[model samples]
Target: VHHGNGTEEILGSDSRFLFISSHTRGQAFYPGTGAESWKNVLNVPLSLGFSADDFLREWSEAGVPGRIAAFQPQLIILSAGFDAHRDDPALGGRLETEDFLRLTEHMVSLAWGIESCHGRLLSVLEGGYDTSVPTPHRQRGGALQRSVEAHLKGLVSSSRLPSNFTSSVLGKRKKPQCGSIASV
Candidate 1:
């Protein structure tokens, strides 16, 4: 996680930050020095091979629900950048659209029951370059509506109710044996 001001704001704290980002490691990319900030800030930059599970593990260890039990955030603004997708010609990452949705889902889950809490969310486009030549996957006029729809549908289908979640900060819940409903 590459913690920064925006991430600090997103997590609603200057401390105990979790900002997951991917950038060229000190290469001659425009507006460089992405990795340099990693060590200096509250960021916990995982090396290569830090997949989504690793992120979840770190997030969990950061005392997620315990932290959220108080100081719940009202909104989540996504600084979305599709350039991380594998089909993007500019970046080297292999992140599929599903990866974005999964990450988005995780963040959304952090804001669960926002309606009851009177909260809202907004998403904005921050970075990405339009390829002059039209790629087969990329529609003309830079329309990724199809991909967005697929990602949104995947998000809905992939989401689970809170009670259905077996994971806890402590550990997984133990399941009862078959035909043992009455044992409770």
Candidate 2:
């Protein structure tokens, strides 16, 4: 899969933004820059056939979640890329749809943990394969759609989740109430 090479490059020198990238590793993959972590950048490069458990472990054992907590960023920006999905033709990053939901739940809690964030999180649509044709709504594979739905479902159920998960990803301005998908 194509890694966040450009974003990392753009923000590499800027300490104001911490660059944490997780991607499939090795030369066979595209844009192999994030093979190592140094300075303000934390690269959680994964080997081929990385399973759901391995993918989730990046936030823990790989030291990403702690780093984010220590940093306590004011604004949390997420590049929601679902290309690692098993259904995707990308590299062997085998994360299922439910994994995205679980990750999003944790991310929502993590973002709210930063007192300054105040549920202000931005999730940009980054990557998801299967758009073989330019059809209506870019109808990605079920994994991407379900993963996104699962991700949004986590956001919607945020109020019930831990750490005051009133994330702005709920698509609201007048309090973090659940809204329609169009808002997202």
Choose the strongest candidate by lDDT: 2
Question: lDDT tens digits, residues 1-184, model 1?
Answer: 2223355445534444334344433333444333432321323333333455555565566454344435444554455655545455554345555676676666556555543322233556554443444578745433233234334443343243355433532157543232342231
Clash totals, every prediction: 0, 0
**Model 2 lDDT, full chain set:** 0.72
Please report how far candidate 2 places residue 133 from its true position, in Å. Answer: 10
The TM-score that candidate 2 achieves is 0.80
- For residue 112, give model 1's deviation from the true position in Å: 1.1
Q: Rate the local accuracy (lDDT) of all candidates.
A: 0.45, 0.72
